[model samples]
Target: MKGFVTAGTLALAFVPGLASAAEPVCLTQAEATSLVAYALPQAINGTAKRCSAVLPAGAFLRQHGSELATRYAGQKDKYWPQAKPAFIKTLGADGGDAANLTRSLPDDSLRQLADVFVEGLVSQRIALKSCDKLDLAIDLLSPLPPENTAGLIALTMEVASTAEPQVGKIALCKG
Candidate 1:
């Protein structure tokens, strides 16, 4: 699903110079890139799944820092756990196992999906923890819908290319 915000929604999402009434929860492009970079360690070590599951979403502030900061600031802990299963399924020795599950995907695309799936860690926010509900948000990001399995396939590709190195770098810097 390629993002579907209408002009109105985009406008509403961005009020004045801020990102709507929500403020930016803003992270500069560099910051956003760093956050994603830090996550790679988890993905590589097999702890990322567990670490990320318990890690606060606010921890990845670059992507949605402001919202999470405000949403979770001062809270004892803002951990998400429902995503445990998906995270486990994502790991493979060389990091190609998950991609192999999908047919005909490019290596680059596989890498991207790996990162997005990691980013998709948002499901940790909910208690249900079911893959079904987790997918709803992922589906929304798809912009292509089920009809475009190819598009979903493509999403992993796009997200991988843009999200991995950049955000991860920023995250390490912050840490």
Candidate 2:
């Protein structure tokens, strides 16, 4: 993974100013899991609300968690390249399948989707803040370097899948 960045890196990309304010801290599997557990679902819920037509967030995560995890784990270096465009497209900035779908949406659906996009950005900002907190907190718990980026990404995907049942209980989309 020549250019593979960890989850922490992903967080830093969203909040670069924070990067200079703090040093990277080592994260244990448990701590990493805990952070992802708290953040990923929130992201999914917001993303689902915005991109539900493209993907039923809860059900997709639930049903394909392991498979997707495996695929992403193998292609860890590719995550951002794929994710950035999708993110932009979901926000209706980039043209592609998602933009086309956005065009086809009913007026009410489009309005709601717009809300979802804004909410998703807010959620991402929150998630990044949480990651920053995790970085600071990790120093208190461990003096070692952080775990592998690929492993962290894999773990996040796996944990996110488990949220299916909980997401179902309060999912934005029934499907």
Candidate 3:
């Protein structure tokens, strides 16, 4: 369960603009869930690489990370439509120039940029000590369908947003 928090942190790292926005960008539930589904596989792969040395030989990430990533990756195209608009909105909240530039790019180019950005950020932010716990967490949650995993994360973020409305953070909008 603690590792779930770590997972959330990894997902949040993808939104560097969230912490610097003048006003929070609100994502609808669908948008938030789609974004999580889109990012989760990359986060898993990045963490697996970043923490490989510290994780035990039998760790879930070491043994199954690629498989898990592939499973989630399968859903990427399905989630991308909703994720893109939400992502662009977040960029708009960050600044006009960034939003314009992001919008200017084709979807294929934007997706590539996003994938690299998320993997790099997730890898850099993960702590070495947390690798074991994250491995267990990934293993625990791996059985669920990707949509369920994504929904859980989106729900968690929604609860957190309601509990603490940070000015520059991303929030899941209330229906």
Of the candidates shown, which would achieve the greatest TM-score relative to the real structure? 3
Candidate 3 residue spans exceeding 4 A from truth? 1-23, 92-95, 163-168
Q: Pick the candidate with the highest lDDT.
A: 3
Tens digits of per-residue lDDT for model 1, 6-51? 2112111111111111222233333222322323222222222323
TM-score of each predicted structure versus truth: 0.20, 0.24, 0.83
As a whole number from 0 to 100, the lDDT of residue 133 in candidate 2 is: 37
Q: Candidate 3: what lDDT?
A: 0.74
Order the candidates by lDDT, highest first — what do you get? 3, 2, 1
Candidate 3 residue 65 C-alpha distance from true site, Å: 0.5
Per-prediction count of colliding residue pairs?
23, 0, 0
Q: Regarding lDDT, does 1 or 3 come out ahead?
A: 3
Model 2, residue 1: displacement in angstroms? 31
lDDT per residue, candidate 2, 17-131, as tens digits? 2233233223334433333322332333443333334333444433443343344233323333333333333243446787677667775565444334433563454343233
Of the two candidates 1 and 2, the one with more favorable TM-score, higher being better, is 2
Q: Which ten residues in a row have the lowest lDDT in candidate 2?
A: 166-175
lDDT, candidate 3, 1-175, per-residue tens: 4444665554464354443456777889898788778888887888898889998899999999999999889879998988888767766634577767888899999998778866776788677877776787778889998889888777766655554333226687878
lDDT of 1 at 3: 31
Model 3, position 18, has a per-residue lDDT of: 47
**Which portions of model 1 miss their true places by more than 4 Å?**
1-99, 102-104, 123-175
